[model samples]
Target: MLSVESLSKSYGKKEIFKDISFSVQPGNIIGLVGENGAGKSTLLSILATLQSPEKGSIALFELDYKSKKREVRKHIAFVPQDIALWEDLTVEENMMFFEKLSWKKKGKEELKQLCSNVKLDRWNERVKTLSGGMKRKLNLAVSLIHDPELLLLDEPTAGIDLKSRKEIGNYLKKLALENGKMIIYTSHDMDEITNLCDQIICIGEDPFYQEILTETGKNILSF
Candidate 1:
């Protein structure tokens, strides 16, 4: 559902990615890996339409990103590494706010169901009162209010407890396998990469590596 061609980015003399190209199809989970300061987040930001690359082209389902960002954004949801919640708002309030922003207007039951899916069960709890893991789950749930076709999660499971991490992993797997969402998430954990992704892509340097991690009973998403 996505194609990137010869993407390059730089800040003054320093460069990020150069000539990086890859494609991700529906039901595919792309695990992006690189060392710190490798521009993993930068790439995600470009894909999220928060920033434009110095040079390159991105196409989402054949729709050019540069010229069609508004249309492209409707089909994409981004969960960044940082917690993006109103500290004073109740969890349910946050969901409702984003729902309105997306103009999806999902009903209470559906929103709660999404929260349940992400293990954010306390609807009336304020954001500042939640644990780190719960906050991450809430961040994830907010992004899914519109059910975008492509999901970009930056360090989704980072800093969470083991149980919460596992919960996030299973939920993401279900999103790709059952709902056919194309997911690209960054992680420092190779185990998470092997367990969750259909492919592993290592960025931040030349000779970009994209390798299929498994061919077991997985439902491969054809490009």
Candidate 2:
């Protein structure tokens, strides 16, 4: 559902990626694994259309990101490593606001259901009062408000407890299995990738280090 071809990016004098290319099929969960400076996040950002690559192109569901940005964006959702939420708004209100922005309008019940789906139903309190995990759940819920076809999640389970991490992973797996949504996620946790991804992509300083699989099987990497 997503294709990235000849993707390369650099920050001033520092080069992160060169000719990085990959494709994600429908109903597949792709795990992006790499070291700290391996360009995982940069590649994701390019796919998310948040940052333009210095070279190469991205296409989502056949729509070229550079030429059909609006249409591509409608089918893509991005969940960043950091939680993005309105701290002062009540949990329900935050969900409602984003739902309206993304989906025109969503009933209270529907919003509540989404919250529940992400295990945030009990967090009806104001966002400022919720714990970090609660806020992360809120972030996940917001990303799904539009029912995007391609979901890009970056370090989504970072800093959360084991229980919440599992919940998030299970939720993502359900989305791919039940809804056939294409998922591309970046993570440092080997266990999460082992459990949730149908295929894994290991990126490093050299593009040769990257590998894609077709099953949830582990492959050891040699430096």
Candidate 3:
């Protein structure tokens, strides 16, 4: 559903990555791996259309991102590394806010169902009162509120308990396998990559250091 070709990005004097190319299809769970400062999030930011690449093209559903910004955005949802909910808002309030922002206001029942799928059970609890894991799920729930076809997650599982991690992982897998959502996510933990992704892309200091994980996610080798 997404295609990127010859993508290049750099800072003033330092090059992050260049000549990068990849495509993601519906029902594909792509894991992005890289060392800190290796530009994983930067790459994701470009894919989310929050930033522009110096060179190359990004297309979503055959629509050129450069020219069809609004069309592509309608199909993409990005969950950043930081929590994006008001700490004082109750669960219902938080979902409602995002739903309205999506320009598609779903009913409370629909919103509650989204929270339930993310394993967030407290509808009346304030955001600050929820556990770290619940917060993560709530973040995800907010992203799904729009029902976008492409989901980009940066450290979605970070700082959550193990159970929550696995739960979130399984739900993501379900999104790909059953809901036919295309997912691109990043994590420091290799195991999360192994457990959730159908393919893995690794970035490193060497510009040529690109590898795709096996379908089982058991191994990574050059394409």
Candidate 4:
């Protein structure tokens, strides 16, 4: 489980979010929605342990972010808004590079399977040669190289075609339901949000922080 309580952050005199709280259970696909300056990316960055929160606490699987930063990171993966890859490298090379950086290394077969999961079969094709959607898919595949339990994505489907978007959405759903991985992603597509997310967390601009269940007759949590 993921527990966030009274979370707050600020930049100098500017406050981003204050007293934000929520919890996510296993196998839940959460959609984080807000305006441009709503701090969606900021929140994800904090959760990913890339930045420290000025106040509040975050715990994943009972591990506190402050005291167990390294351990927590082992089970967490963050896919940033911008694709992080070596454009000059091939698909397999990129995967190998990220795998080497991970704490837990995966075998060649395992790495190949990860690529297959995203349908990225062009092992020798350079990242620069792949299309936008393929690159996004490859980005996701690389993030999963460590087999993290929690996945954080930022506009993963942005600039992708309908088919590619659907493929990525399907793969995410599979990972959550079949693999029991927790997913939190930020997106502007309502249709995608409605179709992929089990719950929606609205932040920034919105006076009341809320978590709305996408499923009918489900309970809604608001603060």
Please give, for residues 39-95, the per-residue lDDT of candidate 2 as tens digits. 889878888888999998888878999999988889888999998989999998898
TM-score of 1: 0.91
Q: How well does candidate 4 match the true structure in TM-score terms?
A: 0.92
- C-alpha root-mean-square deviation, each candidate: 3.8, 3.2, 2.6, 2.5
lDDT of 4 at 44: 93
> TM-score for every candidate vs. truth?
0.91, 0.90, 0.93, 0.92
Q: Please state the error at residue 170 of candidate 2 in Å.
A: 0.4
Per residue, candidate 3 scores C-alpha lDDT tens digits across 1-223 of 8998989899988898888888899999988887789889999999999999999999999999999999899899999899999999999999988888885679989999988998889999999999999999999999888789999999999999999999899899999999999999999887788877777777765434343343343534222
Q: Tell me how far the alpha carbon of residue 161 in candidate 4 is from the true structure, in angstroms, after superposition.
A: 0.9
lDDT per model, in order? 0.86, 0.83, 0.87, 0.88
Give me the displacement of residue 89 in model 1, in angstroms: 1.2
lDDT of 4: 0.88
Which sequence of candidate numbers ranks them by TM-score, best first? 3, 4, 1, 2
lDDT of each residue in 35-151, candidate 1, tens digit only: 778888898899899999999899999999989989999999999899998999999999988888884779989999999998889999999999999999999999999989999
Off by over 4 Å in 3: 206-223
| Residue 143 in model 1: lDDT | 94
